[model samples]
Target chain A: MTALLEVSGIEKSFGGIRALNGCSLTVERGMIHGLIGPNGSGKTTLFNVLTGYENPDAGEVRLDGVVITGIGPGKVFRLGIGRTFQLTRVFIRLSVLDNMLIAAQHQHKWLRSALRSPGQGGERAKAMELLDFVGIARLAELEAGALSYGQRKLLELAYLLMADPDVLLLDEPAGGVNPTLINQLADKIKELNSAGKTILVVEHNMEFVMGICGRITVMHQGRALLTDVPAAVRSDPRVLDAYLGGAEDEGLEAEAVRTEGGSK
Target chain B: MAILSAKAKPISKGKAAVVVAAIAVIAVFPLVFTNPAVTEIAIFALMFMATSEAWNGFAGWSGYFSLGHAVFFGVGAYTFAIIANDYKLPAGSGLFLLMPVAGVVAMVAAVLVGAVALRTKRHTFVVITIGVFFIFQLLGYNLSITAGASGLQVPTPYNWNAATFNNPFYYAAAILLGFTVGLYWIIRRSAFGLQLLAIRDDEERAKGLGVPVWRVKLSAFVISSFPVGMAGALFAFLIGQIYPNTVFNPLFDLSWALMTLVGGIGTIAGPLLGGVVLESVQQYLNLYLSNADIYLIVYGVVFLAVMFWMPRGVVPTVGDALRRRRGAGEATIAATNNGGTDSSSEGKATGSLAGVVQEGGK
Candidate 1:
């Protein structure tokens, strides 16, 4: 399968500190791929680079064989890659439906959208469908800022889906979600994957990664240590060592407690 | 959810009625108050509404607070003035003929300024816009094409009688007011408005969600400039003259900004309501306090007070309070009807978001 997303030798720095150093990864079409690392291991930075929020000092980002490096975020979005932040970013004062509608409007020219009425045409139905898909249809008229953390994550996902992007980049989907919701999220990811959408998930939840992702890429000090299938990557000694000494241990403990409760 | 209380429904109805009544009153004001001085004040009120509403479009909704909106207003005035005075465009050609020219000039200037200044955020963008306004003001002051500091005099139409000039002033003001209201109505109900609100709330998030942030902002800036330009053109013709300093007065700029803020920064009707109220107040103060400049001081204090008390502005805050009281009363009614068993739990669940959605849906 051809790679849907290709990042080669991407490097970035903020003054003296290196945020990403020669980081490289490739994700093929129609797979749930996970990128996991300790905090400051450049996971978010990599997402930023791929989404064109930050330009890499050295490297190229290609989507479906087209180079997209140094482009702005809006252009990156138009090029069929969608993303969500680690912290949920939402239009707080707008209703949940309005939030989705705004995202759905990306397909139209700015002038056309400006002249059109809000929630008019077919956009309202589409927005409602997306909201229902995320199980937030009941909250459609509510302000987005008032959503629960898990609902916000689902809302973000719905917003991304509005663009109907070829590649979805999710930064820590299960980061602050409850375990019950994490299961729901995993199922949602699997559902999305089955529909043939390519997903690049940056997750610290090991169980979530092991359960949902088909392949896993481990990052250490801004470089990919390994990219392998979930089972192999789970058994990898270097991955375990990186987790034990690094902050991933805390995440591991959380996973263990969740599993322990599940057994009971 | 809160019980359906009588209070909630009436407040909304009353609010809508009040707004409608106010518009009715305004429409009749020029007819009733035939005094030229009072009519002039009415015209100023209309101008304030136009400028404030335009300012609110970009600054209040999109969170791109621009200090340079006066740039577009000045451009419109200057463009029309130059065309009419220097080029000797026929007055009988109708003021409508010059609207597009003024709009295009303002839009081009806005696009150029926006391209550079929009790259910066927050205070940086604000500063850049202010700097741009200063530069444009200086250019108008220096260029003979713009009549330098002396400015251009828009001659009264020779063919048309004096009544044409006086009556047309009110008619122009009415047209502008109607256009502004229509523009806001469209904006408040459009996808672009939603995108603008999204950007205002969280720009980075809006961008990641596939909103063309810069493009949306630029479009708003351009659209917002059109009205200012048209208003400027009308003002030039109404006054029959313009000077660089008078056309580009920062005091007038501040007043527009203040009116929008005091009205309720982001809402569609806020600026119009604020403009009318503030302008009337200013006119009354001018009548009473001649050389004291008390109006300016009062205007400043009112702005500071509004910022402190109702930062979201008069409309949304009042709406929220009224909604809350109605929601509480409804819940109480619902509890009494349902044997008072689930009251506390219902109250907890029926918080601001739930109440708003429930009410909004109905």
Candidate 2:
């Protein structure tokens, strides 16, 4: 059977740099897959291409056996793919609930509804529920910009979930989040996966990725270096060499490789 | 689930009643004040309110500052003139019938212009709108049908007495202002309006969330153009003549944005309030001041004051203060209900997020 999400031979370039140089990866249905790479490794670029933020210079992306390459971000969203930015892009001027309502209002008729009462009737209740799930229900009425950075990240995740997307592509879900909240976010992701959603995460937190993701894809130099179970990925010398050679950072390599081997 | 008082209604029932009463007084205002000068001021103010509201609906809400809206006002005025002159249609209801034609012409022009402008970056969008406005202005100056800059005379539809003459145009302008405000009230509450706000806030994120950004902006542009065009048609009748330079004047274009800014940028009542205050001050200055240029300078100072003091515009700033007071009152009431333990503490818990960060850092 075709994979739930597939990126095959995608290429992207920004001036002299190749962001995604013939990169390919597949995500099976109902899997919490992690994408890891050193700086400039093109994992974010691949996420952009898949979610239609960036146009691919070549190659194709398929979601559930349908070709969706370069269709643009809006269409990608409508086709059951939701994404969060590396830096939170929540509408700062709007109230937190307004942010979620914009996401839930994907239907055609809700858009054209002239009366405010009917269009917003159930959305606030539903948005509050999502906020509760994300542990930020108390911040529901505040301006989104007024929230802390970690709260904004959580709001972004909650708003994306408001769209009820089947596949989630999260870029650094734990970036800038406090450790306690990072653990909460990880728990939320695991809970979501257990409930049958497909997730693709691009993260640098090795402990978080190794603890939660069943499979991890390591990328180097805009190409996938390896995709395997966390145990094999931890032991693989190629992954270590890529981390060391790519960044000249033995610390990150050691942390990624050694920290979770014994615990698993 | 903690049920919050249904998110504050855009306008409360009491405020709506007050607004209705004010509109009623304004509706019958001509009978009380029959002075021709007063009627003329009313006409100008209402016409300006309609036009400024049109500008605010699209540019203010969408954050796409349009510098060339005179393109619509001019195109609309000229559309009515061309049809009236070409068909030799008298200034009766036939002219009134052709007003919508004027609106349609302006709307079509807006669609064509918006198609190109909406695609470009914001600064480029501003530049292109200004360019298109000048192009239309140039066309008006050169075109023979536009009377070659000498201007075109449109006959009054009805030959009413001097007292009654201003009344029809007064009522027409007033109705148009009402219609424009009503349109804003609907659009502001609609999903389409929310989409426009989203586009304004962060357009790329809006697109990622599946808002048809270009389509929503274009729709706003179209919605804004129609009323502005109709207002132009009424202005042509109000003045009983139209000049290429006069109808298409850049001052009219600038005033629409300025009025919105002075009153409130994105609030529903802002443009009308702006028009009333600024235009009245303008009329007063024009009547009293010996030098016409001095009023412009004074108006500039007022605009600057508003920018510095009340940047969110008059309506929102005042509205926020009132809401905060009411919120404090509600908090006190809730505190009393909770046996004087002060539930307000939870709502007023400043720096809660800061505390979270400090605790989590450990």
Candidate 3:
């Protein structure tokens, strides 16, 4: 299948430090692609560039063969690239349902419908449906700030689904979430992919990534070292060396142990 | 049916009843009272409400702190003054015709200012607005037609008796205030308003959610300028003069910010309640104190007190308290109804929330 998102030769630097240098990756349609790396591997930086939070010094990003480089975050989002932050940025003061509603596309002419009721047009029901999809419908009335960390991550995930973007860029979806919720998150990611959505996930949780991602791109020191099936990536000597030197070997070992000890 | 359907959310019956009764009293207020001082205070209160609500639209709702909204106010007063000076027309209706003209002028200026200012970050936007405010104030001082620092006196076009004179301006102010408040309510329920609130809570996230942040904020700023500009025009006519120092004073901007904060910054009713309470206090202080500066000191103390005790402002703080009390009462009722099993469920919800609240703040 042709790639849904193509990032080629992305070069970004901050001061003297190179965050992304000649980084390249392609995410195929209808697949969960995991970008795995140790801390400071520039995985999040790549996500930021792809989502137009930061422009690359030299590179090109294409969504479905359409150039979207340097379009700015909002325009990139409109062009169907949804992203979540590593720190989980949500409207903390707003209710969870309103949070989802805000993410719903407003197609009306700007000035014409500005005076109309926001809660009209079945947006509420759609938002609630998304909230239920993420298992947070019961907490929809509470301020998003009231949600637990795992729940916030789930809400952020659900918020992306509100737009039903062509591609989702999730930054560390499994981080800080409990094991049970992490499994559920993985299941949801699988379900979304099976439903034909393209997902580009940046994650540190080895087992979670290895279990969910069909294709794995191993990044090291601001570059993609290799892209292959998860099984091949898990066994690759270069991937092992990168993780061993980069201090994420424990997570790598955990993935191996989980796969051997469990069904996957 | 239209009114009910238009509401973004259902209003409590108690609140609706209270609002109806309040509007009735205000409608007949001028008919019963003829005291100029009382009428003047009423007029000032209405004008302040309109201006504060206008300022609250963008600044309070979107967390964009604009310290230079008086730029529009000054632009409006000058628009009216300039038009009145240049045109020789029929008496009573001429001033009314200029109101919308002043509003349009202020709105166009807002579009220009918002275009440039909103490009900057929030803190820088405030500074840019201040810069624009000073530029206009300087223009007001130096422009030959503005009559310089001596100011311009607007001639009373119509031969109006005391009640007739006071009544029209009062009604005008009241109508403007009503329109502004209604517009605010409509915006609060609209999709654009939700976008603004999203930006307020988290701008980057809102952008990621596909809200055109700059454009939505600019629209708010332009809409806000209308009522503020119109209020400025009416005030110019009410006072029968326009001056750079008085009309475009930075204090007017401060008052707008202050009134909104006192009411509850982002709440719909906050600005109105804040305007009424603060304006009444100012009028009282003016009546009681010979020196005006002491009242300024009192304002500082009141601001500090509110900041310390009710950082969310009066309305939200009180509302939260009432909600908590009602929640506790409901828990009590639910406990009796369910033989105390509801207590643990309630505890589970709030207990987990305490940790999340602190975590979310980070």
- Count of backbone clashes, every candidate in sequence: 1, 2, 0
Cα distance off (Å), candidate 1, residue A225: 0.9
The local distance difference test score of model 1 is: 0.77
Whole-model Cα lDDT of every candidate shown, in order: 0.77, 0.78, 0.79
- For candidate 3, lDDT tens digit of each residue in A75-185? 888888889888888777666767887887444556655666555676767677778888987776566777777788889989888777989999988877777888888
Question: What range of 10 consecutive residues in model 3 chain B has the weakest lDDT sum?
Answer: B340-349
Which rank order by lDDT, best down to worst? 3, 2, 1
Query: For residues B49-141, could you state the per-residue lDDT of candidate 3 as single tens digits?
Result: 889989998898788899889988988988888888788544574587688789999999999988889898888988998998998899899
| Stronger candidate by TM-score (1 vs 3) | 3
RMSD of each: 6.7, 5.6, 5.5
Quote each prediction's TM-score: 0.85, 0.90, 0.91
How large is the i-RMS for each model, in angstroms?
9.4, 7.5, 6.7
* Of candidates 3 and 1, the better by DockQ: 3
Docking level for model 1: acceptable
Best by lDDT: 3
Reference-based TM-score, model 1: 0.85
